[model samples]
Structures are given as structure tokens and as C-alpha cells.
Target: MKRTQNEKILQIQNHTLVVGIDVGKDSHYARAFDNRGIELAKLLRFSNTAQGYEALDEWMRMIMEQKAKTEAIVGFEPTGHYWFTLGDHLQGKGHRLGIVNPFHVKCTRELDDNSPTKNDRKDPKTIAMLVKDGRFRDVYIPADLYSELREAVSERERLQGQLIALSNQIHRWLDIRFPEFITVFKDWGGKTAQATLKNFPTPARVMAAGAAGVLQVWQKHLQRSSLKKAERLVRAAEKSIGRTAGSEAAEAALANLLAQYDMIAGQRQRIEQLMQELLLRVPNAGKLLEIRGIGMVTAAVIISEIGDIRRFQDPRQILKMAGLSLKENSSGKHRGKTTINKRGRRRLREGLFQVMIPMLAINAEFRAMHQKNLTRLVNPLNKMQSVIALCGKLVRVIYAILTKGCLYDAEKMTNDMKRSMKAA
Candidate 1:
């Protein structure tokens, strides 16, 4: 079934059935076309159900029966989570599936029928034609356990982001209610600070409690040095001129926010447990963990996002996926500066960034590289840029470690790096 570049693309035009699916939440719309781009069947829309799946299967079966020699390729947009169910169903039936750019779909809509309009029916055919022209990649669904682990980790990240946002909000509230609170405890969630917030949400409440009473509250709630910090907090609260909000309202909001924070924290813990289990089973994860700054969570994030390292033949592909690759804008007369192309999997890029930070402090190779890049003649990047460049290099290092199944070596790596620089 192999063909030359042009031949492979042209071969799709001979396919018997081209199916376009407009995926949605509760239902999906499908349209079919023949080899000649002639609409064959009426728009077939189905619910997201067992019966709907059955109907979809029957429709494809009928098409196969009619054109025994031609193939069936289904195309759709990667519209968030809406495409997953349909994709799963298509995969289950052993039918070939393809995806089209949502942007491409939108641009082609007006020109497809020259109607200056859009609807579900026309979209399916256009998508099918796009697929027939070999304009899509077959989406990969990792094996079941890997997929579940990936989802769990992704959910944990989302929850963690929300927790951070709430914590920031609480910090802002404290600034208005008790400006000196930050000086007392750096974080609102600290043992001393949370207890203080829960006991005396407002400056007035702390004043009412007095130094001795506030100390007792801290002693009861926190196990720190006999509530010494708590006594200071109370004194600051009494002398502070920070604005006050209503006691009942303030208490309720703080309580509810803390409750949500705690709940999300628990979910994150469970996610970590699941990730630990999954990482132990993934091939060579322990070796990855041996690398400085690569923790269980960060390692899992990289492994899960990157699926099989074999898919990337070289480190550059991995770097590109992490959005660590540079984008150069140059013309015939003018040479433009190079900037990072941040157009890849954001989470993968973020995971690599997190890995780079601790590595900068612990990994000798990374520290050296960070220092080396800072001396560049052109626009030298800041600390963050150096870390990002290290992140790109880290991707290569990880690929080497995973593929070669060897331990990380700083000296050998340094020599190889020197050779590469000389060649460059």
C-alpha cells in the first residue's frame, strides 16, 4: 500500500467513501461522499449512545458493501474532548480515521458551496474531502492504562492551577485586611498563618483576642514554638490600620475557599499515588528518576506526554514538541532575530521547564550550559531563557537515556557537547 509522495496523496481521491464527522457533546453529524466528490447519503446525525454507535457502524457497513474495492476514511476536527468518543468508536470498528485543522475547515466553509453560510451538513463533506486529499494525521490513542494515567496527571495539574489561583486571592485579601500577615508567615497556607486566618480573619478579631488569647489559639491549632509567632501576629493585628470586612461574611468566604483548596489538595495526592504506581510499571522510568531534578511527577509527565520515545528519531523532534525550538524570521535583505516558537503541547513545554529549574542547581552539565549561553554575543537570554534552552537540551538527554538504556554521565556529556559545538 506504499506510494510515492504525490501518489499517496492522489490515492485518497479513489477511496469509495469519505466520511466527515462534526463532533459535538451529545450528538455528532456525519456526511458521506463518493469517489467523485458527489454527495451519496443524506446527512446522518446520531446521538452519543450505544444505539448511535450501532447506527454509525451500520452506515459504514452499508458503504463497504456497495463499494467493495474502495476504502473508507473518516475525518473530523480535534474539537476538545468532543472528538474522543467518536474516535474511540471508529477505532473499535477498525475503520481508518483522519483529522483536519479546525482553522482550515472554517476558511474553506464559505468557498465550498459559495453560499457565504455554514451548517453541519456541508462541514462533513468538506472534512471528508480534506481527508481524502490526505490532509490529516491519524490520531494516536495510547494503550488504556497509559491513557488513564495521563488523564489523572492532567486533572491533577488543572486542580493545582486552581489551588494556586485561590491561594493568590487569599494573599490579596490578607494584604487588605492585615498587610503585616505576609511578614509573619510567607504563605497563607502555612500552619501558623492558616490557624491565624481561621481564628481571627479580621484585625478587630485579633485585637479582641489580645496577645495571650491569640497565642493560645495558635498553640491549640498549630504545633509551632509555643505560639510565639502567634503573639506577634496579634500585636501587629491590633496596631495595624488595615481595612476590615464583615466578620461573618469574611469567615464564610475564607472557610469555603480553604475547604476547596483542601479538597483539591487531596485529589492531587491521590493523583500522585496513581502516578507513582504507573511510573514504576513504565519502561525505564527508574533510570529517568536517577537523573538529577527529574522527580516521579515530572518524569511521569514527560513519559505520558511523549508516549513512546521511539517516535522521535532524534532529540530535535522532542525539543520541538516541548516548544523549545527557535523560530527565525529572516528575509533576503534583513536578518530577523530568533524567538522560541511556543506553538506545541503547552503542558509538555511546562513539564520540561519545571524539570530544568532543579536540574540547573543539581546537574553539573546544566549549570555549565546555563553559564555558557549567557556569554552569547547576540541578545543573551535571561535566567529563564537559559533554563528554557537547558530544557531543550534536557529533552535530548532524556531521549538518549531512554533509548540507550544507560545512566546519565556529566563528563561524557560535556565532551560530546564540546564536539558538537566545534562542529557547529
Candidate 2:
């Protein structure tokens, strides 16, 4: 929908220009209005490109000149990547920019026009009205380093998943070729097993090499393992009337799998290096790393997700952003359970979950709280549920540390422990 910047200006108690933009994949439809809600200009469309940016700037300038002395407030929906460029460009131009929620725009659109029909021009106006009412948030644009770190870490996660899948495929190949092999060795990717597999791709090859030849390979490539383990593997290989898969096929599959594994391992190393470098630059990263289980990767994820923690007015906002907010479903007669809202940034939620896992396992206070929350009539959360609840609360702790610039309070957990004890 297009916005009327003039209508926005007319409705404002204070003199301001409201430029509502309906973001699109390749272009943007916009409307401008004055504080009195008067339409000062007709509908305009511009390409979502560099030239389009220039055009938008020229048009904004013309509107400012026509209004003479009023300040300009540009508003647009958070329309995925399409709006990012425009938002960045407008912020660069020194214009005040606010982001309207797309959900709010959809609900408000029908209220403005009950017919449910929509046009690009109409949507922008609705967005501008929402902006004029102060129902918008300023977007956070991370610094270049944080952005690069975010991309790097995200790629690392993707590669890790791929590596796992490849490893699983290798396991499946092993099962088909030698079913009893895994019973003796847990992970085929371990240094000794990888060396064993590289040397003897098939059961027949291992049997041919016997115990002495197998120990030689392990000694050459994986020096840490004792000859005893190699002898055990040789014994397992000799006893097997294992599957008769072709030697050539098994060798080719093993070679391909190892190559992919090596590539992913290299990529992961690079990602870790980048993450550590970027994390060192973030405020209080050293303090965060000092917390057990919160290493450079975890610190990087937390910092990248919560860029410029000062932007949050309070710690609760960070909790809500991470979908850690509590939601109750109580009614007149039915007293329902409370659960997490679970409707915000996924990565933030994941980061908090990851952080809480180690804490729950090792931190004395967290373990006590979890057990204390697992009673019958007074407390109802199961072990798993209690852990999730602790993770949700952990969001508040992390937020407090970031927002208030406080140290990780090993003692602060006492409050939750006391509450659970009282409930029990």
C-alpha cells in the first residue's frame, strides 16, 4: 500500500512529514503528507535500486522544501530484505525512520477499508498512519564487523549440519559393508577409525592386512591410540563374514566422504577464527567468556543477535525479543498452564537455550532450582519443562548482564531457588 506523507503531517500534533512506503521486491510505492493529514503529493513509485535511492532523496528534499520548516518522519513495514536497503539509505540521509509491523498493517488495513481489497497506494498510507501514532520501532543496523561475524557463524552452523549428514551417510555405508564394525568402535570419524578406514576401505582389505599391518597404519597417522585398539579392530575384521560389497565401490564412497569431511573441518576452523576475532571486539566479551560453557562461538552468537544492547530500554524487552516471555492462558473458570510465547527471533532463543544447557548441568544453583520446580501439587513442571523454564529465565540474566553492564551473578540465582523452595 502507498502512504500519504501529507496526511501523516496533518494528523501530527507536532509539525512533521510522514512518508509511508509500501516496500516491494524491485520497487517501492510511496505517499507523502503534512502533519494535518492533508495529501500534499500524489502516489509515487521508485525502483528499489541506486537510481531509485537518488530519486527518493530528491523527492524527500522537494517535500521538505514545500513544507518549509517541519521535520520528516519516514515509515515503512519491515518487508524482509527489500526494505533493508531503503531503511539504510533513509537513515544515511539523516531522516527519522521507523518500522511498522506488517501484522499491524494487515489488521489495520481492513479497519481502514472494510472491503478487504488492497492496493499498493493504500498500504503505504496505513503504514504512515501507524508510524504517526508512534506504533513503530527504529531498526538496528549492526556495524560491519558484527554483520560479517553473523554471516560467518551462520555459515559455520550450516556446514556443521552438512558434515553431520555426511558422517551419517558414511555410517550407513559402513553398516552395509561391515555391520559389526560400529559395535567395536563408536565413531568412524575418530582419528584411529579414519586412519583404519583410509588404509582398509573394505572388510577384505582389513583381513588381508592382519593385526601387524593395521597397527602400522594407526601408528603412522594416529599416533595417540595404543596398538591394543588396533589389534581389537583387526580381530573384529577377521571374525566377520561381513557383506560382500565391491571393494571399488566401498573405496570410492569412503574417499568421497573423507574429502567432504575434510573440507567442512577446514571451513569450521575459519569460522571459529572469525568468530573469536569478532567476539573480542564486543563489549564485556571477556566477562562472557569467563562464564563456563560460554566460549567464543556462544559469545559471538549472543553479541551478534543483541547488537547494541543499549538500544533496549530494559532487560525485559530483550527477553520478549528472544521469545522468552511468559504467556498465561487463565480464564474465568479454567486456570491454564503458563508457557513461553515462542514467537520472536529464533537465533536468540537458540542461543539462550544453548547457554542454559551447560549451566543446568554444571551450575549448582541451576540444578537446585530445576529439582525444586519438579514437585506435585505446589510445583508442576517436569524435568525437561523445568530446564526449558530455567532457560527462559536465563534470558533475563543474560539480558541484565548486557544491559546493566553487570557481572554474571553466581549469587543472583538464589532468588529463583528461594521461589522454587517456597513453591515446593
Best by TM-score: 1
lDDT of 1 by residue, 1-424 (tens): 2223364466565555788998888988998887677777778999999899899888877876876635777889988988888898898877777778787788777766688577777888778877766666556677866787688788878988998998887877777767887777777887777787877887888878877888887777766645567677777776787776475777678778888888888888998998889877877667888777789999889888887776666788777766778999999998997778886678888899888888888988778778877876666678877887788778877888888888888788799768856765
Top lDDT prediction, candidate number: 1
The global Cα lDDT (0 to 1) of model 1 is: 0.78
Local distance difference test scores for all models: 0.78, 0.77
Candidate 1, run of 10 with poorest lDDT: 1-10
Badly placed stretches (over 4 Å) of model 2 are 1-13, 34-39, 115-119, 226-228, 231-250, 375-380, 403-406, 409-424
What ranges in model 1 sit over 4 Å off? 1-16, 34-40, 114-116, 220-223, 226-228, 312-315, 320-331, 376-388, 422-424
Q: Model 2 over residues 1-424: C-alpha lDDT tens digits?
A: 1134554334455457888999999989999876555667888899988998899888878877877736778889877778878888888888888778788888899876686778898998988878877677666777887787778778888988999999889888887887767866898878877887778867788889877888887778864757677677777877776678576877887899998899999989988898888777777666677565576777788778877776776666776777878899998999898888886678878887887788777777777777776864665788767877777666666667765678887676787577756765
* Stretch of 10 with least lDDT, candidate 2: 1-10
